[model samples]
Target: MTMAQRIGFGTQIRKSPFFDATLRWGATGFSVYNHMYIPRDFGDPVQNYWNLVTAAILCDVAVERQIEITGPDAAQFVQMLTPRDLSQMAVGQCKYVLITNTEGGILNDPIVLRLGKDHFWFSLADSDILLWAQGLAVHSGLDVTICEPDVSPLQLQGPRSGEVMKALFGDSILDLRYFWLRELDLDGIPLVVSRTGWSSELGYELYLCDGTRGDDLWEKIMAAGAPFGLQPGHTSTIRRIEAGLLSYHADMDADTNPYELGLGRLVDLDTDFIGKAALARIRDQGIRRKQVGLVIDGPPLSGPNTVFWTVKKDGASIGTVTSAVYSPRLDQNIALALIAAEHAVLGDRVDILVDDQPARARIVDRPFYDPKKTRPKAELKAG
Candidate 1:
């Protein structure tokens, strides 16, 4: 297959809003930014408030959804690839699952949404999860099918997501709960509505059959949300940084296991799954390193990768910051870092390297905020 055909979609269209909004927001332009893939015409703030905070906004996350399973052995074959107990996953339910190599190293982090008894959709990062799953299917000799679904996803995220959705769908959406999804027919087009999102706020995601419905969906959401102060917005990397969400490549990679990324709860080691043995060993023997939140005092003096902890008193570097941001909520610079297992203590002081200078840092409990999941999930979620 040609490279274009291999991508399984049309030529990538960067939402114009990405460049337009960044210039208007008075933030650093994308010229130097390396992480977030923004689109063209990514819109101006209706007022000045972040669009997500005030009203609902839509994002064409077409790049994020990729299906990698097809053929006869797809279903049963892919089950053993992750650490999650897939047998318990109900149809139409979405659960977070990790894709790993046989050695138990992470390959991609994706949400496994069981669409049918034998079909699955894995919304993943910019990784080769599809290829990985195919490799496993060939090795396992299971007669199942796997292939990327021909669908592009759009996200409606914001605090007023419900209000906007109510205006459009007429209150039918308010009943959906977090992680729940339903099929809806709008304008005679089939779409899957899921109360799941990436924004650390109340939101919902919609998966349409293709890009043909993109314009209509966008217009409808905006019109419905007008009364609720909805505004168009794009994904913000900095915001996620403060929210303590892990970015696949930035915060973790193949060598990093879920346990090392503070995702031990998601991995049911007790249940049979790939990587269980390695994780069990790590848990029993104890990890030599751990991921922790860092509270940095003073001005922001370092970027990610700054070492702030050591295994011995100046003996060797144990860990470095994987993610960091100047938090708008706490008005302090907070960071997520991996540190020596022994040094992972609450209120423990460590050293942070800032501008080649060692600065004193302290280990704080994670989340850095929202220790309690206090946000309520309304039925019609938008992100």
Candidate 2:
């Protein structure tokens, strides 16, 4: 394709620094997220999932943009954005947090990195949190500067990711604890390496601090991982569903509350936040819908469902299946669904319309792969 043909998608949508690198390395399809082009395809998704679990895969996740918050009142201003307690979050630590609205509805679920005493970066899922923060700062009597920094991230995830990291950053990278981060210099290539990722596997997110070095960063990591069987891949939907990770707009959105997803642990009612009062009311009254796991009874799904499948208990519709996939390892069709609280009992069976064809499923436990997360938490001692 010529440059004009390649660039015909319009310049309004931003491209990541690793955009060109991704296409060269086998990225076949793309999707839009946070107004940026995100690589969604790099061959068969099932093969991508296997490549991730068995070995390692390098994913260009620059679309997971960072919203940088800094200033004297930064900490306080950040606290107002979510119900999660940030008082005990030490510097260089990472915490998975839910950004909520005043109505106690979830805005986005992001992993926040505490860079300094008053500096933080919200590694977002897929929403405009930068605009939200800037808007909040205008009226809230807080002195905080909110802006989008020139940062892009790549995910090097799988069982052998540590070996890949050690090859690139040496033994010191092993000491980097899970959910913690440290800034590192890779031959003068700026980065903030963190032991965190969306996949429930031992992995690291390499945040490229300089946009100009995107190509260099991608090539260096791939070269180091080549000996370890690393393949260029996209985030795995089958694996993520097995891990029970919530997608921002899919599983829960602006209308979904924290309690419904069994994520009340992230909320601190004692501390005042944007949605404390509304959440307290929810806590008192109880939630209407609840998130649950399901084992759909049928043949293996051809692929992950693209739309919400209607879930019905008996003859009446109760909820909808947000995410569903066929786990090759488990040999079962697993799904995450949201249904009325009264009908969400374990072992209860429900009917679902899979492409308008009737199907049956039973309520089951989620994170079907690793509910305890023992794999991701396992130490990275050199072999």
Residue by residue across 1-383, what tens digits does model 1's lDDT show? 77634543223434322233334434332211112244423433222226665566666565665575544544565567777767777778887778866556687777777777676788887676767766666667577666666666767887777776667666677887788677887776567888877666678888776555566666666677778876565565444665677777667778887777777777777566677788777767766778888887777533334333332225457687777666555767777887777878888777766655566677888777655544425334444
* Candidate 2 overall lDDT versus native: 0.94
TM-score of each: 0.82, 0.97
Q: What TM-score does candidate 1 reach? A: 0.82
Angstrom error at residue 119, model 1? 1.6
For model 2, how many clashes?
A: 0
lDDT of 1: 0.65
lDDT of each: 0.65, 0.94
- Model 2, residue 367: distance off in Å is 1.5
Clash counts per candidate, in order, are 39, 0
